[model samples]
Target: MEEKYRVLADTAVLAGEIMLKAGAETFRVEDTIRRILRTSGFEHCEAFVVTTGIMITLESSKAGTISLNRRVSSKSTNLGVIDQVNTISRQFCQGELDLSETFQQLKNLTPVRYPEWLTYLCMVLTAAFFTLILGGGPAECFVSAFNGLYFMISRILNRRLHLNDFVFNMFASFFMAFTCIAIQTLILPELLAEPAIAGSIMALLPGLAMTNGIRDTLEGDYMSGAARIIEAFVIAASLALGIGVGMECCRLLLQALV
Candidate 1:
């Protein structure tokens, strides 16, 4: 019985960790952990979740107590994984799955990712449309598409190199800004750099992060909310810094040429 309780606590904490790292709301994460533990017969279960950490404890007169702490250093958006975990938890609670089966399911779960070509195509379309919406002409839109393509490639390479979010965003933004300026200066002198840069850089913005931060704050997860907000700010600042540096360097190059 004690061994079973230990497994339950560990599995519940693991589920919460995965959800938290997948960018789920803090309240939702806590609720999920609590529900899992309660369903597993741990009536005195406690789960505390933040954007970067998870803590869970289960206490029972018969089983003593079990506790765990997991620090999450990286996060990404994976709704599919979140949904799968939620389903597993629901099934377990309904007695459709035993503890061993639940553990196996969670252990074997995999995140779904879009195809590379599809992702690239979507990025191109996003940049092109954003450029048009920002009052750029068809020529500028075309240029922005190429910039977006390169930006996507840079992001993929950064991820492959295992760079952090801030570094990856900075690198991608620098590449985007430099390419936009170079294209405007050399290939399409008529191309407006402002709209092209703005449109392409939109792809690198921390929109989801900012939104989640606000949501967490409103839900009373103040610490997690503040951390996410600060993260978003840092990421945005890095992107701006990269863009500024790239533009300044391009300006200097143009001046030297003239």
Candidate 2:
């Protein structure tokens, strides 16, 4: 029935919306929803819902490199239609739905927007690169950088604006950095001399945000993507701030020797 297809399409759209806003890919959601739908009795139906935020805005660079901003959000949905969509997706997640035949239907599925942890790792990696550029040896720099990054990212994700994220990273980074050094000291003493800067950097990459933003833009989901990009840049700035503070402290202490 035409009605059934509409319902199914709408359902797929909503699934995409939820995931996009939650930092997931449109195609990924579509595939999952479709998989769920196909396995359900409503497989023939196509449902769709246009999210308010999944819009993409493109910007072209001077070099003619085109970039886009992605954002995704839900506007409204039909309860009855949504309920059916929910049933299918839920069933699929629960393994109650059979989509063996529909598996290939999603080969081109957009990337599954990465979770926060992945984003954090990217930040750490970026930080490590910078730290290495700064005078810290490769091994030591990563040890300290990653230690700091882990505490910083973990606290930030689990606590957001809460004092926990802030204070935890502030203090935990130092501890984690030391822990990394200690571990290296015990297992790979060769790495003990690696700069704390490197360790701190490794601990800070926010890979997810960059990937999510790009993915969002590609899917014409600008709202979610822009928001994520802003967040990622903010995190990058914060890492820079931390490094600056550390450098300042070192400068002050080293002044006496000079």
Candidate 3:
């Protein structure tokens, strides 16, 4: 009986952690945790979730009480994991899944992402099209695409190095700005920096973060919403700082050359 209760609590907390780290809204995360606990035969279950943490408590007259808290340090957008967890939870609720089976499924679930080459190609196209949309000529579009390639490489490196989002974005933006300015000055002197920089930087914006923040706020998860909003702003500020530093360095280099 004690082992069963422990498994239930562990499984519930694991599901919540997965959902939270995968960028699910806070209310949705809390609901999922509650449902899992309730379906597992714990009627007096409580779950509290925020952007960076999760707390769950389960109690029964016979089984005493069990509580778990998880601090989520890193977060990323992986809708695939979120959907898989949701499906498992629904199946559990409907009696299609047992606790052991559900636990194994969650443990075995792997996040799916686009292939690296395909992702790079898509980013390149995105940068190129954005440049063209912003009144850039064909040459500028090509330059922007080239810069996007470098951005993709930097992103991959940052991921491998386990850098934080703010540091990664700052460095990636700096690399983009520096590369664009150098290419413009040396290879295509006529290339406009504004369009290339703007278009390339568009690929680095935290659009999903901001959207999730607003959604969480509207759902009444005010604490999580505020945290996500601040996170998005911090990332944006880092990108801007990197761009500013890169531009200033380039200006100084040009002045020295002349």
Candidate 4:
């Protein structure tokens, strides 16, 4: 009975950790964990979730108490993984999957990602189309495609540097703006710099984070919602700061050249 309790604890914690890391909302994570624990016939199952961690406690007359805590340090926006976790938990709760089988499935679950080439291609297309949507000409669309390299460069540098999200995004946007301004000044003077910069930086915007923050807030997850909103704001500020610095530097250099 003790061993079974331990296994259930492990499974519930693992599911909560994965969902939290994959950007699931606070209430959702807590609810999932609670449901998973309830299946074990625990008299009391409590799940506490925040943006940064998860804590679950299960109490039964036979097993006494089993408690688990999982800290989540890194997170990314992956709605698919969140959905997968939800599905698995639902299955476990519905008796479609045994506890051990559910645990195995969660353990093996991985986020679905597009190939690098395809991802990059989509990035470029996204920038180009955004440029058009914002009333930019063909030249702007062309330049925005190159500016879309921001994602590629950031990914490469982040793999080696492991900087936090704000710093990483600031540096990437700095590089992007600098290059875009230089191209406009030195080679593509006829192209509008604003659209290209605007379009490319769209990729860096924390839209999903902001949206989730609002949703969480509406759902009464105030702490988690506030944290996510603050995160989105920080990223936006970093992007603005990087672009401002890059543009000022480019303008001064051009003045010197003239």
Strongest candidate by TM-score: 4
Off by over 4 Å in 4: none
Better of 1 and 3 by lDDT: 3
Question: Candidate 4: lDDT over CA atoms?
Answer: 0.88
Tens-digit lDDT track for model 3 on 3-57?
8878888898899999988988888888888888886576589999988888889
Provide TM-scores for the models: 0.94, 0.42, 0.93, 0.95
Cα error, candidate 2, residue 156 (Å):
11
Which stretches of candidate 1 lie above 4 Å from their native place?
A: none
Q: All models: lDDT?
A: 0.85, 0.49, 0.87, 0.88
Model 2, clash count?
A: 56
Q: After superposition, how far is residue 75 of candidate 2 from its true place, in Å?
A: 20
Write one digit per residue (lDDT tens) for candidate 2, span 31-92: 55555445334314232322333322112232122112234533212233334444556765
RMSD of 3: 1.7
* lDDT over C-alpha atoms for residue 27 of model 3: 85
Task: Determine which window of 10 residues in candidate 1 has minimal summed lDDT.
Answer: 147-156
Model 1 deviation from native, Cα RMSD in Å: 1.6
List the RMSD of every prediction in angstroms.
1.6, 12.8, 1.7, 1.5
